[model samples]
Target: MTFLTLLLQTPAAGGGFLQFLFPVAIGLVLYFFMIRPQQRKTAEAKSFRESLVKGTRVVTIGGLHGLLVEVGPETVLLEVERGQRLRFDRNAVARVAGNPAAEGATPTPNA
Candidate 1:
């Protein structure tokens, strides 16, 4: 067969296995690189939310920064200004102040 004709011809064997393996490899790559890191971030955020306590300074997902005045089971009260408090759902908290890792910084071994 001419070089051009040989190049155009499909593989006669192992093509099906190669096709299956390609997609499986792609899935594993996506899971490890994308999905797994996202899951870890979500778990860390949830843990941070659950561990909140009064007197912790936090920033909300909406960019509102305040001191946590009260941490309730389903919500938290934030003191934005002197005598000015706002109540928000617990999930609204994005990260605690002074924690670079929680604010999307590269996580360290001690973080």
Candidate 2:
């Protein structure tokens, strides 16, 4: 069969390594472009979460903005409105609020 003949053909001596090179090269590219950046961002988020203290304002994953009333080992109490407090997992704190510079520099809007 034609398929059997093609499979038995000898690779060119100079380019024989290309077959092995391509998949390894693609894997390296994927790690640098995708996996590495995600790991760095995750580490930054962990650092941000660990630095929290009482009285710091933050936004939750649910978009509820509040000041932190209490911080625990794995949870926090956030006061959303006057006399309205809700407990949330520490991971639910998306990011600290009111200081965009703390997360990253961004241009401010003007009207």
Candidate 3:
């Protein structure tokens, strides 16, 4: 009878350490896989936005492609067509088109 009580109590005692570590291991995994990469992406996007200037072509998040004709603190004037223009919030811009040095380079398709 005493041996049976001792054997059962040993497994319960071992589980206490695993229970304490489970949340910690989950937190570390989340920080590495989710939180850190998102922060890096946000910083890169912010820097790209701050570097905008006139005469640069850009694509908006909504898939609009245009040349930047004018820029303001809160808005940008875009020439989407030969004679048409549109206005959008600065943050709506997605990525700037590459400069002349990159014009001839072809992008490799992703696997």
Candidate 4:
């Protein structure tokens, strides 16, 4: 009876209640700062991959640079080495290299 009362009144050694709570607090902190942000970034990347279209210049996750020649439902055709085409999943594109359509404004060929 006395042991039960002591056990209820006091936590065991090694910081008792605080020890149990510490790991949980750390986990929550990691989730908020690390895990949650990573999940959000992954979702954003997925959305970006879904929204990609043909004729867009893009960089691959493997550092291959190319222009998006065709966009399929799940894959894409990339013109990497000037007339050399390669295929990859849409999600394999790390980022758009540059908007070629937006850079058509040239300051005269003479300049």
Overlapping backbone residue pairs in candidate 1 total 0
TM-score of 1: 0.72
Best by TM-score: 2
- Sorted by lDDT (best first), the order is 2, 1, 3, 4
RMSD of each: 7.6, 6.0, 3.8, 7.2
Residue range with the least summed lDDT across 10 consecutive positions in model 2? 99-108
> What tens-digit string does per-residue lDDT give for candidate 1 at 5-105?
98789577666889899999999999999999999999998898899999998999999988899999999999986779999999999988775346556
> Ten consecutive residues with minimal summed lDDT in candidate 1?
98-107
Q: How would you encode candidate 4's per-residue C-alpha lDDT over 1-111 as one tens digit per residue? A: 999998899955686789889999999999999999999999998899988988888999999889889999989999977599999988789998755665467656775
- lDDT (CA) for every model shown? 0.89, 0.90, 0.89, 0.88
Q: Cα lDDT of model 1 overall?
A: 0.89
Candidate 1 displacement at residue 16 in angstroms: 2.7
- lDDT, candidate 1, residue 5? 95
**Considering TM-score, which of the candidate structures 1 and 2 is the better prediction for this target?**
2
Please give the distance, in angstroms, between residue 94's alpha carbon in candidate 4 and its true position after superposition: 0.9
lDDT of 2 by residue, 1-111 (tens): 999998789675666589889999999999999999999999999998999999998999999988899999999999987789999999999987886344456546761
lDDT assessment of candidate 2: 0.90
